[model samples]
Target: MTKESPLKTLIGLAQDDVDTAAQRLGRLQRERGEAEAQLQALITYRDEYHARFTESARAGMAAGSVRNFQAFIDTLDAAIGQQQRMLEQADARLEAAKPEWRRQKQKLGSYEVLQARSEATEARKSARREQRDADEHAARVLRMRASNP
Candidate 1:
């Protein structure tokens, strides 16, 4: 059995690492998107709630009710801020994974290039060996014919 090329093995391992990094990056991106969507939904709800409060105030809302709406809106704003921070963290992680993936991909490419060069070198050596053998056989045949004649 032919031995496996070490460079090929290194390439395979690097490819796997790159694939894993890509998957991680995809997950982080999805998480960031979900967080953004949630933040938007919360903002929308907060706007709609404030609009309702405004309408109620125009119609002369009770003092206690106005205080409660203000408190809840404050809480929503805090939650939105927290979600934004979470999304930022996720973005950072995804951004970090991108560089790791690129590095692995570059490593794999280098290994592939090395393997190609090695294969080409082996092919050239084999062709040279075959040509030398053919030449020797031809010389032997000519020598034999000349001696016989």
Candidate 2:
């Protein structure tokens, strides 16, 4: 079996790291989006509960069924409180993830930049070596012509 070149191995490792980081970043973004959606849904539920409680109170005054209506309203209020707490927790998680996501993205960018610079440096070095060889060939040709003439 042919062994892989060290440079190729290093490049492969770097590429793997980049791919892993990208996947992790994508997952974090998806999680954040899901968290936001859940929070929005909870807020909607909370609003619906509040509206129902208000209507129930108005109906209770007209129908003289205050006790049962108040109990229902209290239950809805408790549900709304629970949902609000959940929404706040989701928001907090999203906030905590933001900085970590940014840092990972920055790390990926820096790795790409370093790879590009290394490629450019290698190209420049190769070009310089080729130029030096061409110059030596020209000098040898000049010496041959001078010696023969």
Candidate 3:
């Protein structure tokens, strides 16, 4: 088996880091999406409840019923505000994860570049050795011909 280059090992590790970062970024994005969906759902529910309350009031609701509706609507409004804050926090976390993932990707790319350059250098060296061997063999064959003749 060929010995592994140290650079190859470093590159592999860097790639793993990049993969981990990407996964984390994906998770963060999913969480952000979920939070946003929840926020939207809360907003929709609040709007629907408010509309129902308005309809009841127009249809001659009792004073007690109006107060109850107002109180419940106020509670829903508070919950919606809380959910909006949670969504904002999720967005912030997703934004923070993005730069770290990008940094990992850049690091992996740099390691890959080093590996490529190392391979190229080895190829050049091998080619030079092969050329030198061919030239020596040709000279030896000519010398033998001259001596035998």
Candidate 4:
């Protein structure tokens, strides 16, 4: 059984960490996008509702109806405020995830660089060994031919 190099093992683990971090970052981004979209929808709905309320008031609503419209608008405004807060929280979470993702990727890159250097060192050693063997073989052949002559 061949033993795996420690650097290779570290590289594998780093790759897994990087993948996990990337997935987490993607999830955070998706959540933030969904929150932002929901907030936008809420704002658009509130604006449309306010416009309708204004049109109705101009068309001569009763005092009770005017109060009801104002109350409902206030409720919509409160909901919009809550949605804005939710979106802000989502944005914060997404921002927090980014650094972790970058760190994991950097670790993986460092491992890869180490592995490349190790391979290059091995190749140089192999080349030197091959040259030494060739030189010894040529010297042995020359000595044998001179002895026979």
Candidate 5:
């Protein structure tokens, strides 16, 4: 069995880094999407609740009921604001992950380029060796025929 070269080991390590970085970026994107979805849901619920509250106030509502409705709406506003902040934070994290992923991908690409060049050079050397062997065999055959004749 042939021993692995340092370049092969480096390529493996680079590939692992790229995979890990991509996973991290993907996870951050998922978290951002979930945060945005939750924010949208909260906004939709708040809008529907406010519409109902408006209709109830126009028809009739006791003082206590009005106060409770207003307070609940205020609470919903605060929660919506908090969710917006969370979504912003998730966006920031996702943005941060992108650079690392790009860096890892570039490193892997560099290693792959080196590997390709090395393989190409080795193939040329092998072809040269094969040509030399064939030439030597032909020369030996010619020498043997001359001696026999």
Candidate 6:
């Protein structure tokens, strides 16, 4: 059975935490992107509706028609209302996700720091062990030579 050093184990745990945090961050980013796209689409739809409404009104005025202009105005208002609601929802979602994303980023930073510390500790331990072994071997060689002389 192979035993793992405590520092190595800690480093592994930290890395796993970092990976998880990164995944969460990525998910949040994707969500934000989707929300932004949806918001932009809604804005585009609103603009198109506005343009149609204006054109309809102008045509109705030229033809002395009332019903078409009224209908276009109603449609434009409804579309604008829907777009406003969607924009509000998107903004809320984005605001809510921002804090969570920030927290995940902070957690990733902490994990990285922990991993770095663990690695440094492990490296120091390895160097110390190597130095101790070398010192022991030199001491043994000196004893053997003195005994032989």
Give each model's clash number. Answer: 0, 0, 0, 0, 0, 0
lDDT (tens digit, per residue) of candidate 1 on 10-111: 888988988898888889889989988988998999999889889889989788998899899999999999988988988888888888888888888888
Could you tell me which 10 consecutive residues in candidate 1 have the lowest summed lDDT? 3-12
Write down the worst ten-residue block by lDDT for model 6: 59-68
lDDT of model 2 at position 66:
62
Pairs clashing in candidate 1? none
Sort by TM-score, best first: what order?
5, 3, 4, 1, 2, 6
Q: What TM-score against the true fold does each predicted structure earn? A: 0.88, 0.64, 0.94, 0.92, 0.97, 0.63
Tell me how candidate 1 scores on lDDT: 0.89
Please give, for residues 71-143, the per-residue lDDT of candidate 5 as tens digits.
Answer: 9999999999999999999999999999999999999999989999999999999999999999999999999
lDDT scores of the candidates, listed in order: 0.89, 0.70, 0.91, 0.94, 0.96, 0.71
Cα TM-score of candidate 6: 0.63
How many residue pairs clash in model 1?
A: 0
> Which pairs clash in model 2?
none
Residue 123 displacement (Å), model 5? 0.3
Task: Record all residue pairs in model 6 with backbone atoms less than 3 Å apart, i.e. clashing.
Answer: none
lDDT of 4 by residue, 1-149 (tens): 99999999999999999999999999999999999998899889989988988888898989999889889989989998998999899999999999999999999999999999999999999999999999999999999999999
Model 4 whole-model lDDT (C-alpha atoms)? 0.94
What would the per-residue lDDT of candidate 3 be over residues 1-149, giving only the tens digit for each residue? 99888988888899899999999999988999999898899889989988888887888989899889889989988998898899889989999999999999999999899889988999999999999999999999999999998
State the RMSD for candidate 6: 4.2
Which 10 successive residues of model 3 have the least lDDT summed?
50-59
* Model 6 alpha-carbon drift over 4 Å, by segment: 1-64
Which portions of model 2 miss their true places by more than 4 Å? 1-64
